[model samples]
Target: MTMSDDIVRMARAWIGTPYQHQASVKGVACDCLGLIRGIWRERHGTEPETPPPYTADWGEGGGQEVLMTAALCHLMPIDRQTPMEPGEVLLFRMRPGAVAKHLGILSAAGQAPRFIHAYNAHGVIDSPLTTPWQSRIAARFHFP
Candidate 1:
């Protein structure tokens, strides 16, 4: 299968994982970054590099594109202006003037695009990419 297909397959396996800070386990728990880490491990055999401990306001303080930089280093950057397809990884800015800190895997396209992501209060779940969510998207990438 294609790498994107593999990514989607692996992400789907994390569907029921409980959301937890700094956690990464399919049946147990994981956060947004954890979900990406898990998918990377499954596809690439090992994590490209270790991540340092980060706070809840990790990049918010400096408004740095920490996650975006890491994604460019490990993942293939894509055109954000173009329409997104299934299996693409999306980086989102939760709000204006805030660092982009959220991530999700696009799972469907066309009339109603859906994405799967792990949230703090709610575990991993797929939600439609409604208008509100679309406006927050900052970038998109694909697994290599």
Candidate 2:
């Protein structure tokens, strides 16, 4: 199977995981970043480094693009203007003037694009890439 297919399959495997801050155990609990971290481990063996402890308000308080920075360091950066493809990582700015913190993996692309993310209160789910969500996309990357 293609790498993108592999990514989608692996991400789907965690669909039932509950949302838990800073956790990454499949089918048990994980946060958005944790979902990505778990997929990275599945595809690449081991994580390059462990993330530092962070709070829900971590990004807003720091004013730093920590998520984007980490993605740049480890993943293959894609131009923001580029069209998204399945299996690619998506970096979202939750609000204007805020650090790009939320993350999701593009699961389907085309007329009705979809992305999978560990969302608070909803757990891991494949959400449609609606206009509002698409507008929040700040950067994109691919697993390297």
Q: Which residue runs of candidate 2 sit more than 4 Å off their true CA positions?
A: none
Deviation of model 2 at 124, angstroms: 0.3
Q: Write candidate 2's Cα lDDT for 42-119 as tens digits.
A: 988999999999887657886977888888999998987787789999999988888888999999999999999999
lDDT per prediction? 0.87, 0.92
**Distance from true position, residue 87, model 1, in Å?**
0.5
Candidate 1 per-residue lDDT, tens place, 42-114, comes to 8778999988887766579888888878988998888867778889999999998788889999988789988
- The C-alpha RMSD in Å for every predicted model, in order, reads 1.2, 0.9
Q: After aligning candidate 1 to the native by TM-score, how far in Å is the CA of 1 from where it should be?
A: 4.2
Error of 1 at 35 (Å): 0.4
Whole-structure CA lDDT of model 1: 0.87
Please state the error at residue 42 of candidate 1 in Å: 0.5
In terms of TM-score, the best-performing candidate is: 2
